[model samples]
Target chain A: MFNFEITALGNMFFGLTVLVFVSLFFVPNKHRSVTLYSLLFASLACIFYASDLITLFIGWEIMGWSSYFLIAKTADKQTLQKYIVFNIGGAFTLLGAIILIYGACGSFVYSELDFSAVPSGQVTAITILLLLTLFVKSGIMPFHYWVVDSYSQSNDLFSAVLSAIISKTGVFAFILIFFQIITVQYLQTPILEVVAWLGVLTSIIATFKAINEDEAKRLLAYSSIAQVGYIVTILSIMGSLSLEAALYHTVIHTFVKLLLFINVAAIIYVSKQHRFSTLGGLLYKYPLNFILLVVGIISLAGMPPLGGFSSKFLIYTALLEEHKGLLLAAVLFSSASAFLYCYKLVYGIYLGQPTNPKTEAYPRIPLRFYVPQILGAVILITLGTIPGVIVPMFNGILGSVGFEPVLYRGVFVLGSDFASFNGGVVIGAFGLIFVLILLFFVRLKNRSVKPKDRLDISYCGEVPRADVNLHYGYGMGRELSRIGLIKMILSRSSHALWQRVSTLFGDLSGITQKLYTLSAQNMGLVIFAFFTILLYMGVK
Target chain B: MQKGFVAYNNEQKSLEAETEGIKNSQTLIQKAMNWFSARSMFVVAYGTGCGAIEMPPVFTSRYDIERLGVVGVATPRQADIMIVSGYCSLKTLRRVIRTYEQMSEPKYVIALGSCTINGGMYWDSYNTIKKLEEYIGVDMYVAGCMPRPEALIEGFVKLQESIRNNTIQPGYVKYREDYAYYQANQEKLLGKETQPVYEEDYAGMNLS
Candidate 1:
């Protein structure tokens, strides 16, 4: 009998147990919870590394249940209940896939199971089922409705952990499916191509939704889906380079998202403003924090020299290498469209005028605030600069997955024929040169000119009124919507779909809940009607 | 297996060393080494409510917020702008007040979404506050239930307008005045007074 490794399973169990306890604390003081959650995540990573199917299944269930509870801590009772139901459904599907594999091969161990021995149809079914389960967890399109409600509703700290670690269980599942179950012949079908297309579609739709979103946390939730779409598109390429790029993106994304979420929490914690309409002109007040947040946002946006660009570049190269023209164009368009949202984030909060005159005083940011994000930002920049350091480790991972090794050629330059500097060297040199220029500028400036608060000039003869309420809203996406042709495709709103679904489910559940309260005779009559209907159908 | 462990351990140490080289450190040697590293500014990670939807692009690859000096800060003390995106519930208001209290002074508040201003669709809802002025003051309001990212961008520009104008300043005196008016009004209007759960009164409590 194939048995789960007790050690690995226990690790997952420990993580889940810890998460349950961690959910009890409040924000800004959830350092204890963060510590425990980190431990739990570590345990999970180990279980995934262990890699026996039974062990994997155990770890999977543990991670799902743990994260479900994490979502529960901040979500309303209804949303939490829905989150649990959706998660359980995904978990059960995963269990079924494992059972099917065992039934076919008479083994649950991942290494010994031979996918080639199984029929192509069965393999396809298993792959699809597994993908469904993972997609549900990863917040892929059509299956992603629960994420925003769950994440946005949850406590800020809980949201950070959920976004960072829990959602990634799907990526781990994808890894297993790509390497262990599906072969190249199977992946070459139009089905994989369809999956890639779906990712592109999801990204486009989710980005627009994010652009128009008002709730800060909800916007992040939608952004999470968009980022996941990028990963899905790359992973569906089924090439070694693409897979590696996907991994890179996943790693970078996890940390960047964590930083972003925590930063959101810090803002909410300090400012007492959860809506952007009421917040502005904080950059001057909290210069240190503004700078740190900029680091996180830049890294997230895939700016050149930050961690985001590295992964995006890799994914683009992989797509180009495969000569997937349409996908490349979609990526390009998506990349260009990203600017609108990024500028919104920057200009919306810090760069604008202060409408609320009372918020001029800067509140204290806790020491813990800087520690985690600083560490994350550092890691992102480091990875972006010197990817070669991690190349060997990825190579080992590729070996384990039975993929060929690949190298990262640095950015290139055109010469008489062809000449290129390594990306690391070229980027590193420019970065150095830029830093030198900035330093020179800083040094050249007169120290005697003590910087004072800069204000807007009152133009003309008119005295500027303080209460005109300066803010930019409603017009953020007008240009992009009109210009990008996204208006046609992204017109389908998730909120509308979910609203309809919630209404339907609300009615169905209402009826079901009242079913048992009926008299015994009534219940019997209902059962009789059901049976009669089934019999009539069978007979027909 | 032991050899594999050793090799992995060695690799890990080297990675840490290289990482430390690029990271911000106080030591002179470390600073000298980091001169070549790319400089990035901080951004306050403030999400009000629905308006927060626009933040992803700024932080993500499309807009690349790093070219500018903005980054996401994780705490109130470090943050510069507090971006409130949309509407606020009574439940959320309590936390928001506490968070605002925690942030270091010289902070900014950017309110995103129309709900934060006049409560939008939730204006009549008992749970939501119609006038944000009644509670914590706001700096900039990006008007929309969910404002577009471009609107948020424009809001940021407007916020910059205020900041450069030197019009933005702490208004604790106004809050104090409003609080006093609120207290007196509550006593007169409601007869029995119920203090705000989030804020503290300057005068001593009525023990009797």
Candidate 2:
């Protein structure tokens, strides 16, 4: 039925190849495995172009299992088990929902499935199931336990792949469900609204955890959760442009995470340290890696002239369109939280004084590692400079999904009918201003300013100790954890309160366990009492 | 019945009953004295182990032996109170020393639920302490773990009922002599030689 079947099959093979390769990374003969992983990754790029759901699912499941095995290969048995269980749970839910849809419409074909025929209840159920599956994969809150366990435990290289390639499966699933299957016009439930709120909550909670987490890998894992939360929120907007925003965001986040994780991995591999508390003053030691990390972190922080800003700006526009004032406020709050963690990630690792005095030479990264990171940075910068090229392809996808694709006029006007950003004007002004500043700085440069043995960072009278490590720990989020009404609304302390309620259950279960141990007849009596209560309620 | 109710017989019966009551009263007084002597006071040390390190400083010779009339008692039956200092680790948590039973009337409890107040440094630590009061009831947490010796003394001074009504008959041998149970648990959690290097008397030694 489709000429793209070869592409689909090739992609599926590549996905499997990547999975197999990544799984075997710990083996002594790892070069062949890396080759296989790259081959699979290349094939997956083809799979992304699949014409139908069947082919898509093949690629999808292959990607899922391959990543799962890869993650499993990296983690301990307990974490791997949780990773498998959580992923399988999501996959099965997705499979069941697909089956239900096929049963309702009597087709496996994505192009053939009619949206109008799906009964409201069935549609709602399918949406919920799909959303749940996707949320689990994305590592959204409450469902995020597997993410940290898997990401933090994985080999550093594999951690890069997991953060980049694997979690994007959630975004793919979201596109399929939110765009292809469900019509945005079917006005019924507050499901999307709930998702938006969930995103905000997820960001807040994950950021707090990220702030507290001592392990570098775990911190990155929490950060990934926070980013995915933003993506999910944008997708839930269900606007044509928001789809573009989501896709752009996915691309940006993937590259940024890949870059950051690789840089961190390089740092760890060189220093044999994984905790931020132990890592400091590396800017002087590993200048190139440090620069790469800064680029990645700044992009992650959504600073202007980077990839994060453009996509985030689109999401904000969508929110403004919907007049979601509170959500807009939350978006800003989460962004500020991003700044807090970003500062810690940079200042804690490189800017602060070295705690350990026994200095070691910095290890050079294999060209293989730096290439991918450099490619990612280049893509990020190019995307910021010229958003024109990919905007059309995303428009096509969103248009097919039944949302009006925004047509850009050189990254300024939308659809030739409306106006937005004026890239020419802004870029020209920015370039002129930059040149002037550079000229002034060059002219004002002072040769007399010599390098000091020690730099003063703090205002206190005590001279900056070369050995004392300055760490901004979990206490940074203390301001947000207010004891008042806001905390009552957003905090999960209620889950802890439920522990008290469960204590009652614990008491009851304990008594019951003891009673059953003492006599089976006592259990029979209990069952009889339960039936008696049921009978009484039935009569009433 | 009418014959038994004669007036002279009734008067004789009343006199005999009064004499029997007086004898019963004397026996009751003797029993009360014996019960008083037999009563052993039960105090929940609520020591929470690491903070229990500072207890010797207050009880030993350098701090003066008995100004407050309170001595560290081992068994709950021989103790009248509990002092919770900072941090409770999960492994050493069993010996927190809270008991609802065997305590005499007018018992008091203080909460140390903040790492026993709000899980201070131990909040994020999984294997460390949690809400201490949620398990064994505490009476007047001494606030800080390794609280200043002054604060520990202050807590003791505040607990006067425990001082004045010293009904607890502590076995001085057990209270003042042995430290096996505490040592074993400590050794189990942290192997032998893990007791901090600095002794209480070492003023010049640098401790991190």
Candidate 3:
């Protein structure tokens, strides 16, 4: 059956995709193809609008393989293998779920499928399979072995697209299938709790890993995983308010990641440095880019008066509504610790002393690089400034799907039964206080004498000569690795574990291939023997 | 002589006049700025000699120099004063010049002990610089073989008073007005670079 339609969820994603694609337009990449990118955009649209499982599955595989080729342009053989194997494995699981649904209800269309007819055991299998696909696509942990290498190794512009848009396909798929199609009653509460804990734990571990990383893109890749982890956690709550929280966080995260990846791209473009140790003192050299990066990190860290904090607030309130006290405490702990990596990101590139004298000659960031960052900053601030406006839109999203708006009361306040605050007053107060402090500092003295040179630091009665690596970028987070639990978390390699898994699968395939290499008579004898053994067991 | 030096001298003289005019006028804003800058002193936490041992007691709860609004900062960028805690060997002298230059303007130096004043016990030593002022500016001096924390505190208080009252030309200003004299003296002892050269230059280019 061919089926297609549009819903509020589709519209939100369409708008986001447009925003991302426009920003992606400004990025320069040698491997970029207009035709291929258009194919990707069209396939995503198909997935968003498809009303049938087969149509959705077709779109999903197309998106997967197309992005694989895109990543293949820059990635080495190992990275390419990881990318394809993990993505195709995810696709296969999705296909399994679809096949199960068809066999149970005998329908591929969402409106025609009757889930009640399916046995409880079969339904749980479908849920697990669907969740597996979604986790792999979303780069959720245990399934996230492919994400870091692919994101970091991909071409600079493509990395932005990967983090900002491609990874969110799983989130959209989860909302569409789990919320719209499947009734939540079939899912066990314990399973949802496990998922929620998995998400929060992934975030905590990723934050520490980000701090430990020296490569700029790798750090951002870990940061992307961590931010997406929050969305996954909130969605596991599966309430109407929680749905709103997930969508809200998704919007904020998409913009934040887009801004951050592009900013890093600009840095890479000029300085030609990948590791934080090689990059420093570019703050003044590229002041606008630095400011934009700070804006991105502020939002990424979920600080107040940025759009990041707004979504984070919604997530907390949604959890509180469910009385997930312990889960909320863990979420709070992760958010607090994220500040360390955020500081590390800024300090490594911008704040410290420049180790290279040639940083003075680094080219200015092109005007096009500013386009997306400024757009992102403007939107985030506007969202933060008018916090009440988006709530009604989230409410409208529920109404569009014929879902009841049981809880939403007003524009600013959330969770009437639980704690709520007027967001307008909070934002206004913060804005006013910020202005006052800024004015006080600016009105003071204006006698800042520049140092003789960059190397003129207080080095215990000796000058740091030009050749010494004065930049603290490499050593900034080496302290946290000394701590007990974080050290354990950072030291464990998921990639190595997955490597053993791949090797085992390789050996299994080798044995099967040897069975086929036998002559025709041998193959026939093997089949006959297998059937005879099966028949004897049946008779018994 | 280069006309550039004459032009620089003229600019420097007018700048000094402007500072003097500001000092004489002493508007409420200027006074407020001076008072705050003098009251909240950030001493660069570096030590060259034996007097460094006496610093912890002053900074910590023992002598509690923090009561007088003087606190030690980790870097020269944020520091208002650098305490040359003891005698400077040629090695330490290079660092002192670098640190003093790095400090932001309206900065001062406190030469601690007789070592910095006239080389003290290191007067006859080959490596020691006899007078610290030849290499960098010294705003105040506490001239004991090993000055106690109380004497160091007194030196800080007196320096703060002089800064607040505008009663003396600050050493930072003097350094700025007469940089050539200091650099020449430093080069005489420290060779042409006036910076510690290591690591990068150690390998002979003839390695190939």
Enumerate the candidates' DockQ scores in order.
Answer: 0.01, 0.01, 0.24
In candidate 1, which residue ranges exceed 4 Å CA deviation?
Answer: A1-27, A30-43, A408-421, A432-455, A458-462, A473-475, A481-484, A488-491, A498-540, B1-208
List model 1 lDDT by residue over A8-60, tens digit each.
22333233334323332323553345544554565475445554677677766
Error of 2 at A89 (Å): 0.8
Instruction: Give the worst 10-residue stretch by lDDT in candidate 1 chain B.
Output: B1-10
Return the lDDT, model 1, position A71: 61
| Model 1 accuracy (lDDT, Cα) | 0.64
Q: Model 1: per-residue lDDT, tens digit, B1-208?
A: 1221111111334534544433433357434422322132344545656656688886678776655545777665455566666777665654454455444444456666778767889878987766554566555566665666666656555555434433333333334435666545434433442233223343443210
- Rank candidates by lDDT, best first: 3, 1, 2
In candidate 3, what are the lDDT values of residues A279-337, reduced to their tens digit? 88778788888998999998989887788887888899889989999999989988998
Give Cα distance to truth, residue B8, candidate 2, Å.
99
Q: Summing lDDT over every window of 10 consecutive residues in candidate 2 chain A, give the lowest-scoring window.
A: A454-463
TM-score winner between candidates 1 and 2: 1
Cα deviation of A54, candidate 3, in Å: 1.3
Candidate 3 residue-wise lDDT at A225: 86
